[model samples]
Target: MENQFSLAHLTVIDSPPPEMTYLAARAGYDFVSFRPIYMGLPGESNYNLAQNKQMFKDTKSAMKETGMKLLDIELAKIYDGVDPKSYEPAFEVAAELGARHVLSSIWTDDRNYGIERFAEICELAKPFGLTVDLEFVPIASVVDLAGAMDVLRTAKQENSGLMIDVHHFHRSGDKAEDLLNVPRDWFNYLHLCDAPVEIPSSKEEMTRILREERSYLGEGGIDVAGVVDRIPNVPYSIELPNIKKTQELGYEEFARRCLQTAKDYLNRQVKT
Candidate 1:
């Protein structure tokens, strides 16, 4: 099967949607993921493509010019009291753009409430032909593959699934063998990045590593190849967010290097 690689918006968070699409295409990525909903965190950049008519049109034009597909749009955080219905506009834009997935996470401590809300969001997203992918991060309520599976099992929504980010999988103490227990169909796509083998000393450091210090595939100690080998065939979203590298090389060159390195790493994995 041909590998489908996507330029995750987080990889170039500072770039607008139009530039992201153009750069992804120029860098030889097969698809691009967008972040239409802000993560609601301080210092985070977001774009409201659904409401920005001109930006939306420009992004569409860039995709047309580059022949790049829309892989997904993020992010929907299922926190307590945050209405999933409020995300309808973002879903509308994703559907109009033919995106395949929505990256989401739960922030509440109550597992039951989180599951219910996630299910509701899945139902809401069904009509838009979008899969709601619940990403498991160490800082979030659903912190591991098993926790994410618990929600997926209870929600029982066909349109809901798990989205594994390699950094989170490693930091959460999840093993490559653990992936064997998951149903293959439960995975829609995955986020790929690399990090140092040493675990962070504190939550603050971990957060910094995840958001700003990740390395390209094969550049750090993460067993990206091992994890990739275990997962079923699915598109990969290159999500390395190295602020320093981006500063030195610029977004365009940084993106190109990311794609090339990922392709090279995967090719070596196949050969081995």
Candidate 2:
């Protein structure tokens, strides 16, 4: 089967949705991921398509022109005091863009609260035919496969699934072999990227690396092939965010290389 690749918003986050969509299509990707739901992080631009009508229209125009589909929308964070209903507008926009998955993560250590909030998100997304994929980030509360799996199992939301980002998977110390314990149905897609073999020693350093310096596939120490080999066939969202490289090469050129390197790595994996 041919692998479908997505130009994740983070890969060329500097580009707005319309521009990113065109770039992804021109770079030869089957799909594209967008961050229409604003995370309100420092240095991050708010594309919030739910509220930005002009940007949303332009983005839709690009998608229609390029025939590129929206793979997923991020991120519905399950943190303390978050109202799951707040994501409804984003969910409505996702369905309008034809996206089927909504990415989320556990931000607070309160497991029970996280589970309840995540379940609420799943329910809210259900009307729009979107699945809430719980991604375990090394910097977040659900920092490993076990933590993410436990939430989904306990929540028992049919519209919920687990999202594995290879960089986070390795950083969190979960082995590729550990994927064996997760049910096949829980996997719908993967966030693909590689990082240096040397793990960061502090949360701040780790956060910086994840947001600014992720290595290209096969150029880093991650066993990307090993992890992908264990999961079901699904779209690979290349979320490689290298600030310096993007600055030097520009978003279009960087996005093209990201997709090319991913294909090269996957092809090599097939031959091996």
Candidate 3:
């Protein structure tokens, strides 16, 4: 089987690295998603692409130390209501790092033109041979599997499709069979996380800890194994937003735990 493990940048939000690369590598993650200017960084939450020309290079170096690869660079503002043009730098960085994909979200309300506009951006990436996958987030547009598929169909591009996030499955009230029905080819990545259905808080409450209060594999209420079963074999990543524990346990331990949890889940899945 293809070993597809992804390390999400969200877990290292407070690490003291001038960049996010080292934390990923130290935790034994294969690939990770990075943000040129992450979402909730000080004042520039929206359209937070900084002028740090070396951010990409620094991040690349971080990967070198840890033997980790960059899977995608994030587009955080796209979810917070920033113009799509702001995402160009992230795409540029992903290309520069020799990454294969770029991930972002399109709010449900933006369906008017979000997907179409995304298709237009695909042209820019083809030159670099990168495929873009829009993450189906519950709080963002494309809340459910069907809605996300609509965007993919509208784009009609081989490179664009849905990135099934486990949390969103519960948020959108979708089941495992609903996920299995997805055209297998349309899936590019799997974002793994499990949380309770307690109306998961929004960024309005606290930016960093959204997925943190979650439990490990089979510990939470989410049907994570069932969700994983539906995706076939694809690149898997974790966004364990541990609210309080990360402050105590630190990023490296957090990354290790997340990876171990994922391994446990995948092993059980293989047995199943």
Q: Rate the local accuracy (lDDT) of all candidates.
A: 0.90, 0.93, 0.68
Worst 10 residues of 1 by lDDT: 38-47
Rank list by TM-score: 2, 1, 3
lDDT of 2 by residue, 1-272 (tens): 78999999999988999999999999999999999889899889999999999999999999999999999999999899999999999999999999989999999989999999999999999999999999999999999999998999999999999999999999999999899889999998999999998889999999999999999899999999999989889899999999999999999999999999999989987433
Looking at model 3, residue 247 earns an lDDT score of 78
Q: Which residues of candidate 1, in runs, are more than 4 Å off?
A: 270-272
Which run of 10 residues does model 2 get worst, by summed lDDT?
263-272
Cα lDDT of model 1 by residue, 195-214, tens digit = 99888979999999999999
lDDT assessment of candidate 2: 0.93
Report the alpha-carbon TM-score of model 2 versus the true structure.
Answer: 0.98
Query: Model 1 Cα displacement at 269 (Å)?
Result: 2.5
Candidate 2 stretches with Cα past 4 Å from truth are 270-272
Best by TM-score: 2
Candidate 1 vs candidate 3, lDDT winner: 1
TM-score-wise, the better of 2 and 3 is: 2
Clashing pairs in 3: 107-141, 108-141, 212-241, 212-242
lDDT (Cα, tens digit) per residue for candidate 3, span 69-188: 878767533433455666666677677676887776775376757766677666656666778777776656677788878878878887775787787777677888887677888777
User: What TM-score does candidate 1 get on C-alpha atoms?
Assistant: 0.97
